[model samples]
Target: MCYAKKLNFKLKTCTTLSRVNALSSVAVKFAAYLCTIDSPDIANDYLKVQSLQEIAALIGTTSRHLNRVLQKWTEQQIISRTDDMIHIKDWQAIQEISEDIRFV
Candidate 1:
């Protein structure tokens, strides 16, 4: 019985860590996408027609999750949202976060 409890606890801990890692990866990818928006090598034409939901899907996250991440960024003044658009207020910060793997 004690062994079973330990195994269960280990499973839960692994699951939690996996979730954290997945979210971190998603954030990094999203930040990378934002950072490269103006890069000459990056094609952004798809963004012109994609809605937030479509973009979120392309990024491998749900729209609600993407919105939550954006909301947090707005609170931190890293970006601003008006209507259906998002403007990066701190390109350096976004790039740093993307490179440093910082979630906020």
Candidate 2:
């Protein structure tokens, strides 16, 4: 009976650890996507604050669509754009979003 109880406790601990690892994996994925916001391949260039038209061309998107995306990103505090210039906001804010918008 004593051995059985010990085994059950060990199993519970293992299960809890597995859940933590799973959540970490999800967090990593979220961060990975967020990191792409300032990628040169997307908006890194044209740093002089070019027009949205230029940024759209670089990213292969329409200026209108890019505008909408930018608005949402800004509201989320992920990115900030004034006129044509794009600025990356707090990495911590993005990281916090990554950590929070996760699955169980």
Quote model 2's TM-score: 0.39
List runs of model 2 lying over 4 Å from the truth: 1-49, 92-104
Tell me the lDDT of candidate 2. Answer: 0.50
- Model 1: CA > 4 A from native: 1-24, 43-49, 100-104
Model 2 Cα displacement at 81 (Å)? 2.6
**In model 1, which residue pairs have backbone atoms overlapping below 3 Å?**
none
Candidate 2's residue-wise lDDT over 8-71, tens digit each?
7556434433443343433243343345444445442212224667444433347777667667
lDDT score of residue 101 within candidate 1: 34
lDDT of 1 by residue, 16-50 (tens): 33443465655675786565555566554433224
Best by TM-score: 1
Screening candidate 2 with a backbone cut-off below 3 angstroms (N, C-alpha, C), the clashing residue pairs are none
lDDT of 1 at 103: 15
